[model samples]
Target: MYDHYDALIFDMDGTLVDSGQLHEFGWSETLNKYGIPIDRPLMRSLAGVPTKATIEILLQKFNLTPTATLDEMNDFKEAWVHDNMHNFVKPTALIEVAKKYHGIKPMAIGTGAYTQEAITILGLCGLDKYIDAVVGADQVKNPKPAPDTFLRCAELLGAAPEKCVVFEDSKLGLQAAASAGMAGIDVLLVHAIENDYFL
Candidate 1:
């Protein structure tokens, strides 16, 4: 299915790894400690946004000024996620696609998570070896929906933006792929189809 693309780019959280719940737990725990309530819909809406960016959005959504700075909240949430991810992070079926093209085609991960955090999670899922490069939100000036992350991945892979295909689970990610002039595969719909087929 991906034969035509010169390279493949994947989003980490919901696309390559089943780490959404882990992220949600991290945010929930962090917010609770700060006396803020968790808003699942808002969290899910900002799936492909960077950690600090998401926290900023959440604070605005809740309309509560926090004692902690955005960086502090981001650090606390990321720390919790890193500490607990090993027990919860798992690879989704789409990992088979990455496994299939491991060396045949250049592959990169472009994620909203910090670069090192993405690496650690991929390692825990045994997917780090399959990827040639990783571009995190921290590495780019703008996160998903800006195309910077995927474009950087394409550049690092020596592939043109139009020659790359991105596998993503979030609307922002898909938009980013489009903005990068890359084809996008909606892994959520793909997973749903796969599940139905298996059933």
Candidate 2:
């Protein structure tokens, strides 16, 4: 089905794994500790952003100065998610796409999560074996919407950016894919269309 593409790149959180709720919980806990109110809409809008970047955005949005540094807040949030992710994280249906093209095409995960965190989450979901490379937010100077993450994945896979296809679940991810000059497939819309086909 992906014969035209030389490689497949996936977004980890909302794309390959159902860890959004866990992330939201982690963010909520961290923000609440600092007395910052939870902003669901803003959080959802920054779906593919890095934890530190998200914290920065949140602080800016709330118009509050933080007692904690961005790195400290990120560490807190990441620690919580890492502790609870294995209990709640599961592979999404888009994982089947990765599996289908596993051996036939090179596949990589480009995520806004930290490198080790992405690896840990993929391991929990039994997806680590299928992925050839992983590019995380910390691994590049620029994260999603800048194309650095996906471009790094393609580089690691030795695939041309224009010849790659990115499977993502967020607008930021899609924008990153486009910026990287790859085709983007929205997993949510794909699943919705698949459901309609069955109906």
Candidate 3:
């Protein structure tokens, strides 16, 4: 429960912003540009995966050579996303939640997004200053479903991993939070538990 937590951590893409679909679209389009094909559903499922890891997995899954350069593909994806943020969903629930808890409890970002991109988007959405910390995928060796990113967020937030609560929309993010010994919020549940549960 969040009431039991000293800090609140959020997964950037799906949990806070509506960029998950854009990310899927971006990756899908980028892969296609490389002559590699990927299904939207599959890329959506891999939302919280690290960039390089996603490239590697997609290459194998698409039977393409592992020669898809991570940096280049990321450039393509970012360029597309940078051109389309206003049209994407804003995941206002996250912004509302952050406003509700900003001063009362420490809130931080633990995401599998590139540091610069994450900062740019969060800044655009006013989340950069709102959150206590932002831990990017590049800052860690292992990303979700590993505890590295979340744990780093907890550490930076000055909260014990077990004393923090994580809000995630993907299974991988949930696994990462659980591995960090924190409670996980499956944000996409249509009939999700109410604020009482978090409190």
Candidate 4:
């Protein structure tokens, strides 16, 4: 299902890396410390949103005003996650894919994560230099499900949106790529599809 596209746009957390659960745990711990409870269904809806946008969603969903800046909360989450990454599993294919795609086609990362966080995690996994371009939450005005991040990523990669294909696990990320008129490869459904590959 993914072979037709020229470039592969990857979502960092749950798609290419096995760190979404860790992120959720970290976010829960950090927010709970601030007395910000995590609402399951609501949090899921914010999956592909920017950090600030996620905070806004949480605040409204939880019916509480933020006690701190979105940046501060995000910093807390990133710190907690990085501090606990040893407990998280890195994607086995990260380095191999980079090596295989060295000259195959350009690869870019479009994520709701902060650029610094994305770079740090990729660096920790030794997958940093393999990427040709990156579009992070900090780089776009709107996040996933809005097409801004993917559109910006396509722009940075010098690829047309329609020609780009995105690899994602979240429904929001898939919708974002589709909304941008791009093909989406749902890594979560890889096992059931002949053309899909598990990461």
All candidates: TM-score? 0.94, 0.94, 0.88, 0.85
Q: Per-residue lDDT for 46 in model 1?
A: 82
What local lDDT score does residue 170 receive in model 4, on the 0 to 100 scale?
81
- The C-alpha RMSD in Å for every predicted model, in order, reads 3.4, 3.8, 4.7, 4.0
Stretches of candidate 2 off by over 4 Å are: 193-199
- Stretches > 4 Å off in candidate 1: 193-199
Report the lDDT tens digits of candidate 1 across residue range 1-199.
Answer: 8899999999988888888678777877898888776776666778888878877777787888888887788889889998999888888888889988989999999998899999999999999999999999889998988999999999999999999999988889999999999999988677641211101
Which pairs clash in the backbone of model 1? none
Where does candidate 3 have its weakest 10-residue lDDT segment? 190-199
lDDT of 4 by residue, 130-184 (tens): 7888778888887778899988988888888898988877889989989999998
Span of ten consecutive residues with least summed lDDT in model 1: 190-199
Q: Write the per-residue lDDT of candidate 2 for residues 13-104, one digit (tens) a residue.
A: 87888887788778888988877877677778888899888888878888989988877888898889888987778887887787788788
> How accurate locally, in lDDT, is each candidate?
0.86, 0.86, 0.78, 0.75
Task: Evaluate model 3: give its lDDT.
Answer: 0.78
Rank candidates by TM-score, best first.
Answer: 2, 1, 3, 4
Error of 1 at 158 (Å): 0.2
